[model samples]
Structures are given as structure tokens and as C-alpha cells.
Target: MSEPALNPLLVELRERIRLLEGGAARVRSALPFGVPKIDASLPGAGLAYGALHEVAGGGPGTIDGAAAALFAAGVAARTKGPIVWCMTRPDLFFPALAQAGLHPDRVYFVESDKEEDVLANAEEALAYGGLGAVVAELVRLPMVASRRLQLAAEKTGTMALVVRRWRRPTEASDYGQPTASTTRWRVSVLPSEELPVPCVGRPNWLLELMRVKAGECAEFIVGACDASGRIDLSTGPAHRQDQAGRSFVAG
Candidate 1:
């Protein structure tokens, strides 16, 4: 008895599947959001290392932009090496990012005159493997540009953060356009947590994971990443009270 020869295309596909399996293992071991709901929704229970992630602020201004920037910085803070922040705006408050656990000493800022230039610089940064993460603040990112960034990240295992900003609220709708990012998120400023002593407490954020390749879109209200860059599920009055109690205890 003789066996038939295997198809060359089939063999190639099998090899690719094997490689994907190995890649999946790496992604599973990457950094987590610390919030079970968010982590569980991502592929391999964590954010993919060699992928491009898009984040957009809910409105225009320092506060709205800070929400999105801090979210990206929090994730970057968790990764090893220095963070590269590429932005067209020079008004980035280093203190704010430091409060998110991304200190200025560990951050390298790249200022560009235009949003396109910022994105271009970001792609170059992502292609480099030494940096921990690359954050690009851009008002517009076309599909071709995003896909290029995605490919650059894929090659080097570097994480790319696209912080989409807009001059107008209507301009933000561009986020709905197609992109090659692994996950697309909208980070909105949520009402600050109330303390029992009649003052504000830890900041909160409304995170909408609008698109995830391996998981369905989901929304969560989470305690903003603390000084250590960790966020947990923060919803309901009970949760707020618990946070207040913990703050008092720590104080």
C-alpha cells in the first residue's frame, strides 16, 4: 500500500497554524488590565504585545485628552523599557502621565508639527524593539497608515498606542472607520468617585472597548489606574464606598 502526497499549501497552512499557536501563548502571557472583565475580553486574557491599539477621547480639551492619554500611558507604564510619546501637541502634562505611573524620566517625547508626522514618527518608534511602547496623538489616522503601524508592531513585538484626538466632537466619529488595530477603545472621563468625607476620591473612566478581534465589544466603568498603573472594576455605590474605605485606611 502507498500513501498519497500531502498538499504543499496544506503543509504551509499547518505550519502557519503552529506559529500562531506559539504567538497566542506569548500574547496570553503579556501584561493584564488587572480588571477581570477587561482582561477576560482580550485575546489570551491580556493585551497583545505585538499589536496596534487605538484609543480615542470622548471630547476635545485637556481633560478629555488626558483620559485617553493616561489610559495609554497606564498600559505603557506596565511594559518594560522607556515609553515613547509622539504628539503634535506640545502641551502634554508630564505630571499627569507621572500620576498614571509613567514618569517623565522614563518617557521620551517626540513632537511633530502635524498629526501625520506624529503618526509617522510613531510607526518608526514601534518598529524599534528597544522601547516599551509608542503612543501617537493624532487627529486622523487613515486605514493605510494604521495598517502600516500594525505591521511595524507585529514585526518587533512592540506595542503601539494610537491616541486619537479631534478638534471637534464630530471629527471623532472618524474613529468608526476601518483600521488594523487589535483593539479600539474610547476612554471617557467619568464622574470622580465620591468620598465619605464630602470630597472627590480616585478618578474613574468609562472605557468602551469598541472593537476586539477575539472578543465582543464591551463597556466598563473602572477606577482610573492608580499611581501604580492598575485599574479594577469600580461600579455601584458599594464599590465606591469600598474604595473610600480603602483610601481612608491607606491614609
Candidate 2:
């Protein structure tokens, strides 16, 4: 005796149900940035659904590295959920983070002595879907490890930010770049533009947006942080003008 044949309409209905479930899963993924402009520049109008983002610093005193962390923190803050911060350095200043619009209460700091340990912990955190974001600071990140983290992020729908400190070799392999990430950004502190008023600092930054997946890049002068810990466009002048007495002489 043969088993009854499955109904074709029933099979089609089951496939549709599976597709809807997958769509819902994709929608559940977290975004890693709050800046509207930045998010617009990224694929999917945000970070990839589940992917690892790499932030590499030029040197020890590089403010770019700190900016990268703050960027992720800002994203987590906007998410309104707990953030897991894993780092090899123990000297993380909560106050500074607060100044960058990140609530210390929402952040969970984890310290690790080895880079590998930090990555491992970050992967674990990524596996836990409850986290808004996971940040790990390390000296080096292998391609294989990053791929694993990316996979885990997709499964859990958590955004992963990896801050890489300066190591012997500045260049990295293709895999070192988060293959799953919608975009990659390299931040650095350029000389702040001087304000017209004495003792007042100008809001300016040399921000470089490098897209790994799309292989595109762009540079822009962004406003600096203000009293409210937000980027204030009003703090800077609309355009540069010459003084009344200045001559329009050509060099």
C-alpha cells in the first residue's frame, strides 16, 4: 500500500509560510548606527541584517578609535537596549561615553587580556539576541574569526563592532574586512577648524566612509559634538568669507 500523495496547494501554502517567517527574521535584525545620513549611506539603509563591522585605529592616541566606539554606542543608545562592550583595555571611561550620548547604565563592559578572548566573548554576545550591540577592542582580528562573528550576528540579529588597535601590519586581508557588513568606515581626527571667535572651537571633522562590499568611498567634513552631545550644524558658519580690508589677490 502506498502513502497518500501530498496536496499541491498545501505544499505551496507551507512555502509561503516559510518565506514570511524569514522576512520577519530579517526585520528583527538590529541597526548599528543612529546617524540618518550614515545609515542612508549603508546598505539596507543601515548595517547589514547580521554582520560584523571593523574599526581600525592608526595609533595609540588616535581619537578615531574612540570615535568608532562612540559611533556604535550612539547606535545602541538609539536602540533603547542593553549594549555589551568587550575590550582588552580596562581604562574605559563611562563619563566620556555619557558625553557621547551613551547612557552608562545601558552599557555592560567586559575586560579581556587577550585579543582572542575579546573576540570570543563578542561572538558569544552576538549569539544572544537580546543585546542591542556588541563592541570588541583588539590588536588583531583574523578573517576566519570575523566570518564566524558575522554568521552568529545573522542568527541572533545583533550588530557587532570590532575596534582594531594599531599592530605591526597596517594592511589586512579581504576577509578581515567584515564581508557581511553593509559598510565600513575609517574615522580619524583632523585638525579642528578654528572658529571666528577667539577661544571658541569650530565643529569640523574629516570623516571617511569606505564601503567594503560596494568598493566605494567618500570624504566629508562633519560637525563636531556640542553641549547636548549631538552634532550641531548651527555651530559652524555656512560659508567662509574674506575680511572687508582683505584684497582678492591671486597667489
Candidate 3:
């Protein structure tokens, strides 16, 4: 009788070992973000290729929220091949995304009036291989739904991003609930660098890695995303001016 109980435990142990092996493979094939300060905190020195990541606006539909969208777009721009972007918002400015490196030419947009449909499209897109990435904007993501998305992405080596958006401020507060994402992020906008010519500088963002499943939590304040979505390392002068903000400043 005791032997039967031990058999079940042994089987579970084997399953856990298999899952660990798969995770190790993902870490080996991570996409390098290229910033030493931020990269050091991640398991693979970059975002894992076949994983699900969540990004949220700083305050839901505020300027910080828009910054979060642009940040996600920049990451997508780094990927090769076509991308499927699903959302309910008709206000996505094409020119802005072009500047962030996600060009309109390579992106296919899917708009739906229903929130559930958006997630459904994302799951299907993630299951299909050979695409750059899948980006979905939604307000709620149940644990089961997220788990399905994760499995789908894992099957095809695709990266999926859940861009959380809420119509009301109260709804935004609910994002703290648990999900099956490999990581969760909150992007906040900060004042631009004051230039010598008295004009606005390139975009700046406060990227908070709220939860990271396989590595230490960290924050990165990335300065501009080039046409190819490459971010240079932080400059020396900026670090000296603010010690209170323990953020990684990458250009």
C-alpha cells in the first residue's frame, strides 16, 4: 500500500523534472535586451523567447498607459517576421508605433468589440508558429485562460504579451490578482530630458518588472527606442544626479 503512494509521488517528481528541463531550454534561447544593469536581473540576461509577459499602464488610459503600449511595441519591433496585434481601441496611432520600431507594414491588427474575442484571437495566434509575436490588450485574464496562452506560446516558441487596459480606475486596481505569466510589468512616463536647444527630447519610460517568475525583480528606465528597438546603455551624468531612483537608465 505504501509502495503505491510512493509511485504517485515518483511520477509527479518526473513531471517536475521535465518542466524544469523545458524552462532551462527557454532560458538558453532568451532574447537579449542588451542592457547590462537590467539584463543582469533576468535569468537569461533578456526576455525569454517562448514565454508570456504582461504589461500594464501606470494608471489606466493615462499618459503612463500610452507609454506602456509604446514600450510593448518597441519590444515587438525587435522580433523578426509578422506580428498579430489585437485590441479593442481604435486610437492606436500608426505614426507613433512606427517611431517606436513596430512599423505598420509588418503588423496585422485585429480589433474586436468583445474582450473575450481579443483573448481568443491572441491564443490562436500564439499557437501558430513563424510569427514575430502576439500582443493582446485586455482588462481581465483568468488563470485558466493565461495557462492556455502560456501552453500555446510554449508549443510554437512564440512570445505573447498581455497588455492590460481598464476603462475605469477601479478596474485597474484588480490587476494584482495572480495569473500564469512569466512576468508582469508596469510602465510609467517620466519627464523628458531637457535639451540644450529648448525642444522636447526623445521618449523616456519607467519600466517596472513587478513580478518575474525565474529571476530577481528589477526596474529599467529606458530612454529612446531606435527604429530597430535597440536601447543604448545608460549615460554616466544621469546616474549622478539621482541616487534616490534606483532605476536603470538605458538609452
The residue pairs found clashing in candidate 1 are none
Clashes (candidate 1): 0
RMSD of each: 11.9, 11.9, 10.7
Q: Write down the lDDT of every candidate, Cα atoms only.
A: 0.74, 0.58, 0.73
Put down candidate 1 lDDT per residue, 172-191, tens digits, no spaces.
Answer: 77889998999999876655
Residue 210, candidate 3: how far off, in angstroms? 0.7
lDDT head-to-head 1 vs 3, winner: 1
Least accurate stretch of 10 residues (summed lDDT) in model 2?
242-251
The deviation in Å at residue 80 for candidate 1 is 0.4
RMSD of 3: 10.7
Model 2 over residues 1-251: C-alpha lDDT tens digits? 99766334333433553464442333365353445665556656656646777664322324336665655555556553467788877766677677667778767787777887787778876765555677877665666887888888888677777765543444433324444455566554434557667774643444456665654565444554432345422234444222222222111
Q: What is the TM-score of each candidate against the true structure?
A: 0.80, 0.69, 0.81
Candidate 3 has an lDDT of 0.73
